[model samples]
Each structure stands twice: as C-alpha cells, then as structure tokens.
Target: MDKIKVLSIFGTRPEAIKMAPVVRAMQQDDRFLPITVVTGQHREMLDQVLKIFKIVPEYDLNVMGKGQTLSTITNKVIIGLDTILENEQPNLVLVHGDTTTTFAAALSAFYHQIAIGHVEAGLRTWNKYSPFPEEMNRQMVDDLTDFYFAPTSQSAENLRKENHASEKITVTGNTAIDALKMTVQDDYQNPELNEIFDKGNKVVLVTMHRRENQGEPMQRVFRAVRKVIDQHEGVEVVFPVHLNPKIQEMAQKELGNDSRIHLIKPLDVIDFHNAIARSYFVMTDSGGVQEEAPALNKPVLVLRDTTERPEGITAGTLKLVGTEPQDVTNAMIELLENQSIYKKMASAKNPYGDGDASLKILDEIAKSIKR
Candidate 1:
C-alpha cells in the first residue's frame, strides 16, 4: 500500500502545542507521510513551541509582520499555501483549532479540491464576534472540512447541529492532554522558576493576551491581580507576557515594579507546562490553557466573560470571573482563602482527554485514507 501523504498545518503557539502530538504520531506511523507547514503567525512564540516539540516544518510561511491585521494574516496564509497545496497535493490537509492559519489553510485546501481534516474541530461560541475571528474561523473551517476530529462529545454534537455528517466526525479527545504527557516533567527547572519554587510561595501562573481583553479590561485585571498579591504574603504571580507591543506595554505599566509579580517573556511549551505543574493555580484569558491547566490539577480562573470550553466549568475545574475588577479580585481571594473551594476546583477530573488523542487521531486518519 502506498503511504498516504498528510500535510499538517498550524501557526500559533496554542495550535503548535496541541498539534505537536498528532504530527509526531504521524511521523512514526509507516502508513502515513506527514508534511508539516507553519504559517509563522506568531513568529518567535511559534518557533519556540516547534523547537520544544522538535518539529521542523518543510515550509515556513513567515507570515508575521509589523502591525499585521486579521485580514493580512488570512491573505498571507492563503497565498503562501496556494503553491504548496498545488504541488504536494496530499491525500489530506490537517488544520488545528480556530486560528487564522487554520481557516486560511482549510480554504486553500478546499480551493484545490483537496480533503481537509480539522483537528480540535466543532468548537462554537455561536456568537460570531465573541472570540473575534476565532469563532468564525472554526465554523468556516468545519464547513470546508472533510474530516472532523472533535475533542469531546459536546464538540461533535455541535458539528451535528450544523449538519456535519456523524461518520466524518471522531471524538478523539483533546491533544492538549497528550502534550501535557510529553511536556510536564518531574525534574523540570528554569532559573526564574527555580527561584520561585525555592521561595515556597503559592505560584499563580498567568497568561493573558486577547484582543477583547486588551486596554481597560486588561488594566483592570492587572490591578486586581496586584491587589490580591499585595494582600497575600505567601502568594506570587509569574506572568509570561505576550509579545504584542500593546500587551507588553500594558502589562509592564500595570503589573510591573512589584517584586511578587514577575513579568517574564512568553514561554515555550515545556516551560509553560512545567510552570502550570508547579503553580498553585492559573489565571488566563487564553483558550488552550483552560484545557491544559486542568490536566495538571491546577484550578483556573478564566479572565474572559464567555468561554467555548464550558466542559471545564461544568466539571468544576474553571471559574468564569470575566474582567471586572471586583469579580476578578474576589475570585482570586476565594481561591486563596478558601481551601475547600480550591480543593474542589483543583481535584476535578480534566474533561479534555486521557493522553491518547494523538494515537486516536492517527488511527482515524489512516482509516479515512483507506476508504
């Protein structure tokens, strides 16, 4: 049997973290030839994850630029993959999650009449602009998708509601859990991390960089965080600031100058996972961390008002506090002061996956190609 050629496409740090396991699985499987393409949507951060996963993309789009917009990213990814898709003509093009790269790559595959398999598919906020381009990106990608790899039964049901064929959908769990297995180590160490761990302070690992949460919302959250940290002697925060200039400026202006609040550069997958492992809990406006943090038994206080990952909320692993200062501050205080609440949130079973998502994805891909 001729090995099926599968081209896996992704760009952002979150996408890279989740897709790494599936891509690695395909590389080892003799039944498929995996071709990796990175849109370089996040540049340095994307490269950091790629390096940690030891993935070398055959094509690097290098799509990032000064003050790039959503329209620009979509245009760049579509244009870049046009020739690649025409030349390689793989049996399937696999796109992960709901990034601009995911949508654009799937569009390119559809234009070429090639089959597209969407990993982490069928997630819907239903509100088109709630997550900005992401909610629409996943919906549009699923519309063009020939195969849907939903992380849970809820996501698969979302696909069904949209009239996607059940036969094409596979509930393989989230690959983020699979990534946790590879990243979190018992002896992980970093200079800053080591110092924090040595201090014996309760670490609050924070990652907040979303278009909606920028400006006043972010500033309010930062102020709340600072207040919480100042009030608690044993609590410390390690915030990996996003690379966006606006975000950096805002984070530095509001959250810097405090010894208890450590503002560091964005972390690679390994460091970020280890940080989650070592942290007492997590606070973030990011998507993947909502899924990943729970696997490490860390309670998450979602900084956003609305989340697509409600499974975590239902399972008691996450709390939606939004960006209001009082709400944010009170949630932080509750988790810090209330041991019973913290224990309940921390011990809840991760609703995402069981760490075999990559293998299941591979098996489904192989079966699809055979058919």
Candidate 2:
C-alpha cells in the first residue's frame, strides 16, 4: 500500500509544543508521509519550540505582521496554504488546538476537499467570548473536522454533545503530556531557580497573558501576587513575562523592583517544563500549563474566570481564582498556609494523559484511512 500523506500545521508556541510529538511520530512511522507547515503567528516564540523539538517545516508562511489581528492571521493562513494544498494534495490535514491558524488551515483543507483531523479537539467553556477568539475558534474548527482527537473523555463527551459523529472521535489523551516526557529532565538546571529550590523557598511559577486579562486585570493580579510575596518570608515568584509591549509595561510597573519577584524573559519549553517540575506550585491563565503542571505533581491556580480544561478542576489539580485581587490573594495565602490542601492538590491524579498520546493518535489515524 502507498504511504498515507499527512500535512500538519501550527503557528504559536503552545500549539507547536503539543503538535510536535504527533508530527515526530508521523515522521518516524513508515506508513505516513508527514509534511510540516508553520504560519509564524507568533514568530519568535514559535521558532523557539520548533528548534527545541527539532522540527523543520516544509513551508514557513512568515505571515506575522505588526499588530496583526485575527482577520489578518486567518486570511494569511488560508491564502498561504492554497498553492501548497494544490501542489502536495495530502490525504489529511492535521491542526492542533484553537489558534486562528488551526481554524484557518482546517477551513482551507475543507475548501480543497481534503480530510481534516483536529488534535486536542472538543474543549469548551460555553462562554464563547471569555477566552475571546479561542473558544469560538475551536468550536468552529470542530464543525470542519473529519476526525476529532479529543485529549480526554470529557472533551470527547463535549464533541458528542455538539452532535459530532462519535465514530469519528477518539480519546487520545493530551499530546502536551507526551512532549513533557521528552523535555523535562532529572538533571535540568537553572542557576537562579537552582538556588531558590536549594534554599527550600516556596516557588510560584507564573505565566499569564491572555487578551481578556490585559490592562487592569493583569495589573491587579500582579499586585496581588506581589503582596503575597511580601507577606511570606520564603515565598518567591518566577514570572516569565510575555513580550507584549503593554504586558511588559504592566509587569514592570506592578511587579518590578521586587526582591522576591523575579520577572525574566520567556523560557524555552525545556526550561519551562523543568521549572514547573521543580516549583512548589503554579499560577497562570494559560491552558497548556494546567495540564503540564499536574503531570509534574504541581498544583495550579488558574487566573481566568472560565476554563475549557475543567477536568483539572474536577481532579483537584487546579483552582480557578480569576482576577479579583482578594480572590488571588486568598488563593496564594491558602497555598502557602494550608499544607494539607497543597499536598492534596499536588498528589492528585493527572487526568490529561499517560504520555503515549502520540502513538495512540497515529494508530487511530491509520485505521481511519484504511477503512
């Protein structure tokens, strides 16, 4: 039989990290011709993950522009893939998560009459605008999807609730867990984090940069964390600040010049994973980190009011504290003062995956094509 041709596309750092394992699995298998394409939606951040995972795409859209909008990204990805889809004509086009790139690529593949597979499918908050475009992006992509690689049973149920064909959905766990098996190392070291961890300081690993949480929300969150750092003697924060100019300004104004708060450049995937592994707990508005932290036996405090990854909350691995200053302050203090609560959250079972998601995704894909 001829090899199955699979075209995989992604554009942001989180999408690149989660999709890398599946792409690499397809590359190693003899039954598939795997092609990679990156839209450069988040150029520098995306490049860092690609280099870490050693994935060199066949096409680089290089579509990032100054202050790019959702429409611009959508337009660029669709137009960029038109000639490539016409040229290669892969049997399946695979996209990950809810980025504008994922939605646009799936739409383009639909336009070309090609089968589309969506990885990390069927996640929902039901509040479309809470996560801004992401909630709606994934919902729309599921409509265009021919195969749904739902990361958990909860997500699979979500797809079914929307009347997506159950036969087309597979609960493959999360590919982010698969990436952690490759990146997080026992011997990983960072000088600053090393000393902090060595001294037995309670480290709060933080990453919060969503469009809805910018400006006042971001400012208040920072202030709350800073106040917590002051209240506790050995508690310190390791915040890898996002490079957005407004965020940079807010982080500086609210979180800077603090002895206990370490505001640094964004970390690469490997460093980020290891940091999570070593930290006491995490506080973030990012989705991927919710899964990644629980895998490392670290508890998470989600900064958003709504989360599509509700499995974490149900499993006792996450707390949704939102952006209220008092709520944020109380959550931090509880984690600091309540050892039983911290231990319980830390020891809860990770509901995401067991780190073989890449292989499971590939097996389902092959079976679907053969049928």
| lDDT leader | 2
Give all candidates' CA lDDT scores: 0.92, 0.95
- Give per-residue CA lDDT, model 1, range 173-212, as digits (tens): 9999999999989878799789986798898999999888
Segments in model 1 whose C-alpha atoms lie over 4 Å from true places? none
lDDT of 2 at 43: 99
Off by over 4 Å in 2: none
Report the alpha-carbon TM-score of model 1 versus the true structure.
0.98
TM-score of each: 0.98, 0.99
Q: Which residue pairs in model 1 clash with each other?
A: none
State the lDDT of candidate 2 residue by residue for 1-371, as single tens digits. Answer: 88999999999999999999999999999989999999999999999999999999999999999989999999999999999999999989999999999999999999999999999999999998979899999999999999999999999999999999999999999999999999999888889668767877888999999999998999899999999998899888999999999999999899999988888899999999999998999999999999999999999999999999999999999999999999999999999999999999999999999999999989998999852
